[model samples]
Target chain A: GAGVSQSPRYKVAKRGQDVALRCDPISGHVSLFWYQQALGQGPEFLTYFQNEAQLDKSGLPSDRFFAERPEGSVSTLKIQRTQKEDSAVYLCASSSRDRGTNEQFFGPGTRLTVL
Target chain B: EDKVVQSPLSLVVHEGDTVTLNCSYEVTNFRSLLWYKQEKKAPTFLFMLTSSGIEKKSGRLSSILDKKELFSILNITATQTGDSAVYLCAAFKQGGSEKLVFGKGTKLTVNP
Candidate 1:
């Protein structure tokens, strides 16, 4: 794909139900990132991957929010036991370079609703 | 902890009017600042400022950074209804983290 691609544009999950969101970054991009954006709020960083390495998961709000990029290209963000507070738009981005002033390209994002 | 704050959470302006959005941040490692324009879905990259006093411009949008003050501003001149959207500001942390700390964002609505 020419840009980052996200699966399941919209998702509705019952409380305590688990959900998984997938992201396919641009071809050959070395860096991938996941962010969560609440209504009317900016996208908050959740995790970062350099190639297949999960380098940072500091911005994840809780232990239930887990992300992985197994093959260094496609990534998945899994939420265990969904809560109403977890409702938000999940964004994925990728950068061609691994370091030094690289510009990130973003995906359309997945809107998750927890009820 | 670290935070980024944007002023005038929402704004309404007539077409052809100019607008300026502000962003301030308090972070641990300040490497660069970025501006993005979001419409219905994804946010499109606008500008990235790494040094103080230099401005980045594209079409009718412009932005500048002030490393000393830990702030940045985005300006849109001769705005149109098509320009209405949410503007986001993000500060990049230094070192190898490569994470972006973002502000709440400014929603601009241009009435025709």
Candidate 2:
């Protein structure tokens, strides 16, 4: 695809169940970002990957949330023991360069609903 | 802690009208500010303002940043139905690590 892509556009999981969201950033992009957006709220930063390195994860809400980008191309966010509050749209973005002025391209995002 | 706040949580206007959305931020080591437009899915990039008093423009959309006031405003002229979306403002904090803090976003509705 020409732009960023996310898998499982919509996912419904029961409480306490685990879920994994996938993101395929723009090819050869050096910076990838994960953000969580709740209803009527702006997307909140979750983590950032510079190439294959997981440099920042301070925005992650809890230990149950984990993300990885082994090849520096694809990334995955895993939520363990999900609760109702964990339900939100997970968005992925990729930027061409690692600078303050780089504009990020975003994917369609995965809307997760915890029942 | 860094924070970004957007004013006029929601606005409704007829087509061809102009609207201005406001964003204010308080962050240590501010580097840049960005604006995005989100509809049903992900947000699309709009503009990035680093230097104060300079306006960035794309078609009918334009934005300007005020460093002294610690605020920015997104202006949409001749609004169309397609322009209806949530406009987001985010600030990048520069220091040991780089992080972007986003505001709540302002929802705009354009009626035909």
The candidate that wins on DockQ is: 1
Compose the digit string of candidate 1's lDDT tens values, residues A35-68.
Answer: 9999989999999999999998998999999999
DockQ of 2: 0.67
What does candidate 2's lDDT look like per residue over A3-110, in tens digits?
A: 999999999999999999999999989889999999999999999998889989998999999999999999999999999999999999998876553577899999
Model 1's TM-score against the true structure? 0.97
Over 4 Å off, model 2: A99-101
TM-score to true structure, per model: 0.97, 0.97
Candidate 1 lDDT over B1-78, as tens digits, reads 889999889999999999999999999978888998999889999999999999899999999999899989999999
Error of 2 at A12 (Å): 0.3
Docking category of candidate 2? medium
Instruction: Show pairs that collide, candidate 1.
Output: none
